[model samples]
Target: MFTEISADEHDRQLELHGPLTAAVRRLVEAGISTGADSETIRQAQLAVEAIAETLEQQRHDGPRTMRHAVTGRPVVLADPVIGVRNAIAPPLTVQHTESGRCWTEFTLGAPYEGPPGRVHGGICALVLDHILGEVASDGLRQPRFTGTLTLKYLRATPLGRLRAEAWVERIEGIKAFARGQILDDEGVTVEAEGIFIAPAWAREAG
Candidate 1:
């Protein structure tokens, strides 16, 4: 179910995978937006397919959780919104606080747009969901899954550098109540609140 590795090993793994992820991230945006001719697009497509085939041959057996032995927390290498090793992630770096708050500042480009020049509402939801979940889990010391999430879009979120924050408003026995928001340069764009539930296994461990 999981792989336990030393801190150095994890660092080495990142070194091996980070460059590829970064390259693919650029490739995705370029592939979507390039005004290249058919010939040029054909060449690029061939190159990308070759690269994907090579990597696919070396893929891991299946989904495997990699946990850090020293930190006692699973390494976030493949999270869709924040995974450094995942091409789809904007790779937002979340800063967690002792005060039960978490925030991240990140940039979104043309790929994340929905309405003209605006960030997709769903993308905003994804970012806030992960941020609030992090707050509820307390950095995974207490495993909590999102039970319910509600969002209010005050205005359109522009696609560029943005900041989002979430914090625990209160907690019941097994449910944690949290609220969060996303902001652009001007002000807050989306407001979110969620309930997260700790499963029986987590409670037993606690």
Candidate 2:
């Protein structure tokens, strides 16, 4: 059974989530870049432990998936890719266009940087895989797993504001073909194509 949450409550949770995630990101960045002494490091470790304990005291008992029926999107607070509460995400804002395309605008900061100022190639591939798979899934009405993803790095993606766009190219039987690209201020930096497969369970859902 799906979990049900009030829309107002969800909005409230999201409002508090933004600053919480920002703090976690700051913690990660500082942990990586700081050159403090051993004593300071020890103090930081203690502070981290205290925070972990506080969170553990009121943790969810199990995993839950929540969706909004109207928008065909997950509840923002529970979404991993763009959840304000999830620290792992760059938390891009993905929107569906009227022309059957998906677009997201976001920035990768210090934590996501590689090659002295560029976004990591693997991360670029990851983002493409997700967006392409989303396009293939047709807004989750027909869920698909990425069978294969191919990416070409046309140029180094700088570690700042960027855009990603994806659309379905074709669909045949259980396979959906999709393509996506990541763009920086200058132009396209990475392009990708993917084949996504709807498994038996997903096909049954549709």
Candidate 3:
């Protein structure tokens, strides 16, 4: 489930595609926030269509789980949460991972808004799920899938800079237990706990 690429080749991939992905992220935000007139919006649509077509001219048969040569860590370019190439991701990235813990600092903008200025509840869950799941998986050394995840939204999460972290509480046989929380400047806004399990295939492989 991982595609390993050499350091030089991975850098090449980023150099070629990183800028385009950044532009796409900006475009996505613009699409949600832009107040362009109808004609301008229509023209923009055509231009975006052209860009998509250009990129589609050459394509991978399908997306796959991958790793960056720089980090040598798993990367899912199309992942909805932390995927480097996915425009829709609030684009969370782990800033720290060690001692059975993982953490990240990120901002959720207009595109992720809910309840006027609050971050979407579902989005918060998504963020926690990814972190908790990753921690429970032990950075994929012993990969596991989410068996259950529970979140408690302690307060309305704002649409701006925030921090999230998760850590492995314990592991029992094929299951790993993890806990995580989300915080803003004021402090904890969400708390989460999850159970991650090694699937039958993964258990057998191990």
Candidate 4:
């Protein structure tokens, strides 16, 4: 089941309490103390990663998500799509919905820091792709996945909390077009364009 953790708790674990580093240290200690097989140590380490991922999801202020960190398997709960919807960094939450369009909002935090208190470019891509894909999936019998993406970093996205939004712009046959933007308290920092495609397998499934 999915559970939420307060922002304070997340900070304590990731920053103050140092749960992640502590876990890795423990794995090293175990290896030295017991000379355990490499596989055993790896499995234990994987479990720790799972726990951390689950906790991170609980802390994100977006759609709820949970997964087996070790196997990268979704922890099925309310809706199957909910986990995917929430797993992306700065996970998004639906703010508005209507025919041919969907809207969402979310925040980014220190955990996503790239270069001394700024959001990473890869993370920015993840945010844009998720929202664009979500909007593109709205009316299609077969949902879309990113086929190509183009981005422009107009300015640096500051660390701490920030807002982002995306919407579908057009659709032609199996291709979908979408645009997205990231903003801090100051204003817009990044813009994106994406091309999404409905895969043949998905069409068959639908």
Best by TM-score: 1
Question: Any runs in candidate 2 off by more than 4 Å, and if so which?
Answer: 76-80
lDDT of 2 by residue, 26-81 (tens): 89889988999999999999999999899889977643456664554556455556
Tens digits of per-residue lDDT for model 3, 1-206: 56776678767766876777778988988999999999999999999999899988998774457765566677676788876677788877775544658998999988898898999999999999998887777665567999999999899999999999999888899889899999999999999999999999887887
How well does each candidate superpose onto the true structure, as a TM-score?
0.94, 0.89, 0.92, 0.57
lDDT of 1 by residue, 122-177 (tens): 99999999999988988766789999999999999998999999999999989999
- lDDT by residue (1-206, candidate 4, tens digit) is 33455555443434743444445445444544576688987887798789879878865454333434343332322232222222222434545355555555565555566887788888877777766776776622246888999999998887767666778888888888888887888888989999999989777776
Ten consecutive residues with minimal summed lDDT in candidate 3? 62-71
lDDT, candidate 3, equals: 0.85
Better of 1 and 3 by lDDT: 1
Where's the lowest-lDDT run of ten residues in candidate 1?
58-67
Question: Candidates 1 and 4: which is better by TM-score?
Answer: 1
Q: What is the C-alpha local distance difference test score of candidate 1?
A: 0.89
On a 0 to 100 scale, what is the lDDT of residue 173 in model 4? 84
Residue-pair clashes per prediction, in order, are 0, 0, 0, 0
- For all candidates in order, the CA lDDT equals 0.89, 0.83, 0.85, 0.63
In model 4, the runs with Cα more than 4 Å from the true position are 1-88, 139-141
Against the true structure, what is every candidate's RMSD?
A: 1.5, 2.0, 1.8, 11.7
Candidates 1 and 4: which is better by lDDT? 1
